[model samples]
Target chain A: MFGLETGFGEFFTNYQYPVMIIIGLTLIYLGIAKKMEPLLLVPIGLGVILVNLPWPGEGLMAYEVLNSSTGLLETIPYQDYVQPPYNMAGGEPVGLMSRIFHYGLSWEIMPPLIFLGLGALTDFGPVIANPKTLLLGAGAQFGVYFAMIVAFGLGAAGLGWFDFQMGEAASIGIIGGADGPTTIFVTNRLAPTILGATAVAAYSYMALVPIIQPPIIKLFTSKKQRQIYMKPQLRAVSNREKIIFPLMATIIIILLVPASAPLVGSFMLGNLLLVSGVTDRLSITAGGGFMNVLTILLGVAVGAQMSGFIFLQQKTLGIFALGLVAFMAATAFGVILAQIMNLFSKTKINPMIGAAGVSAVPMASRVVQRMGQKENPRNFLLMHAMGPNIAGVIGTAVAAGVFISMIG
Target chain B: MAEEIIEAPMVGKIIEVMAKVGEKIAEGDVVCTLESMKMENPLVSPIDGTVKEIKVAAGDTVQAGAEIAVIE
Candidate 1:
């Protein structure tokens, strides 16, 4: 008879397990009550609890093997777990979440698909109207390189607190990109072991963009600078220009960085679907129900990766701290670059819009809009900020490609 | 009196209609709030006048340059 042991023993023995469950509950509470990235956080929080639950047999992340001697199913080491296509005759059972993670994330399918959805949903008109803002977006990537250097310094040969290899350092630094799918895509390739921590850090910081960016924006800009008004009317982008943008961008970016082809290619294809006008049905499906389904799966799979054994480490704390640094540095660089641009340009730009270059999409731009209104009620920075906001997405993706090519 | 057409500045769904036909409004008064890219953008009247026509209703998705209202 297969006996089920009460989870109480394991809960008491491994303190980390219960702690992780509490963290999971906290995330759920934040998602529901506080409404912070609820779509992704809620699923991830539930996944954390599910994976942490104590089971008498192989756990949610374990492999079940048939014990010929005892005529019972027994848990096998993760290293020895069988890959997909289990033989039912042999009674091999794979952990459900583990299988999802392997197929969705480990197989490198989900992130690109998510990018396709995001691309389809995005509007590049703002960037098209103000091409110079692309420079601000590229400037924000300085945070990635800055954090990578810091990570390398922390893991120096002798004084290293954590033994981070080249791939691990690159993965950790990409969290500064503040783009979740990009972080996941790069981390999965370079350092799968730290994917859970890096992904969580990326999403959490992104949700906190409103809180995180303002202080840095204020630190870098004066009241006068924040109040600088941009003309409300951007030159209307023609339909022909919109249609050509994605195609042109894909060719240029891929030609420059071949490693970025997967992410950039998927993103441009999605955008092409949206702007082509003739592909309205395909665009709608790509950005609608199909995207929603992937979001849920990606959220759950990422959450499931937060097992206590893998997540509750000193290095995990380091990743979080460094992620904050990356975000702050990215914001600072964007603002500084804008101030520099103003010194030479005829038309003045609100330095605050540069903070939108952090690639959190509408959230970062929203922060700029809010701050701008506070300074000058007539000031509408939303459309103007969006220029760099969308550009940041491309900037982060390109940076991820750079990292992959160099180290991955 | 010159008639002014108020166009939606961006593609989005009209979440709220703040002005009605025959209602007097100021140039900067918000005529409708458009939700685009998950951000709420208030579309304001360009010229102070009576709302001559309301071309959109709540939940109506409007494209950029679509006529939202007419003021005179």
Candidate 2:
């Protein structure tokens, strides 16, 4: 249908697709050259490219789908899919990624499975040995609520030029947790429309943990506070204790926050497999084999959701900016809470370890360790930092539960 | 000579056994590695001593406080 009369030149009219392709290339470059969460980034980067391509073909991303009733193959109209009538349920997926995304993400299957793998790989001993770190985890969750209010304020006041509803606000707020799966799970449930932008913001900030946390932690802590030493050796936890922990934690979390049960349940089940000592094959598969495969699928599916028209909105930029604020606020709250804890306690805790409670797991904890070592060479805070680090995972999940319960 | 019994700190399968009968070892030397919670935790010698006996082999499951080795 494209002769001079039909104007094939209209294909090149909107140049945003080219700009999005360059953005995709930048993400791939960052993953490969910068080594920034490459496991998630590489697949997501490729998906961005696939979804941005303008030309349509069979099995290609953005492929033409047959309108079943009319029996005519039609291109995906951005207007049809961008707003409330997503047509996800009605349309047949014409691309591989579209099919995967339809079944995996929209169905809400991927995030919980990823959490299961994370649980199998996690060590809860550090958290158990130091229960007080649970407060640091809880304290860090302040960022989520704080960001929610900020987003609400922006939308209500019309200052930030974005109108986020309650669900979208709650979803945007979760970026502070620094736990990608929990963020995805909450966003998927609460704000499916903004999932792509929010997921990208959450993961990007997580990858930038090493860069983002140090300055914030340093700003809040003095040299003397940073140099505080924590004992490397943790009291040995018994097998019976380890065996009972997952069940106990699950029961307590479910009883207290029923909404959090899905995420906490998946995570604790994985930990149970690891700690039970009877499920070796299951543990190995959950931690190693299955986890790797799921990461690729989750990354690609999430990336594919970010089609140029949907992702290039002014609201997406607002979400990214607010997401950074939430992250910084979460880190600040964790450290400040630790400093407050020092006032009442006899055995001093390193305030720097408090910063690890942002739930990026070992990355945030490692930053604390490095910062502690810089201030006091003899200070070994890695083990201590892990206590709050793991607790932050639970804290973020609980926070997501709270949001879901109140808002969703 | 006095004998000391080194016990398992947690219930886990032994993935590695570094202790040997009649081998002299320093304090803090790892005697074996245990797999627990998906992490490999090493059981270290509490005191410098000569390894008198190893009670478990690699792949053996042991409970907390179960004797792993006897050092003299």
lDDT of 2 by residue, A98-146 (tens): 7777778777788878889999988888788888998998889898889
lDDT of 1: 0.85
DockQ of each: 0.22, 0.06
Where model 1 places Cα greater than 4 Å from the true spot, the runs are A56-58, A63-93, A157-163, B1-35, B41-72
- Root-mean-square deviation of each candidate, in angstroms? 5.1, 6.6
Writing each residue's lDDT as its tens digit, candidate 1 over A1-408 gives: 277557788777987678889989999999999999999899989888887766622265666666555666766523234333332234343777767777888778889898999999998999999999999998898988898888877888634346677788888788887999999999989988788899989999999999999999999999999989776668899999999999999999999999888889999999999999999998899899998998898887888778777788888888898888888999999999999999999999999999988899889999998898677755678888899889999999999999999997
Instruction: List the pairs of residues colliding in candidate 1.
Output: none
DockQ of 1: 0.22
Residue pairs with colliding backbones in model 2 are none
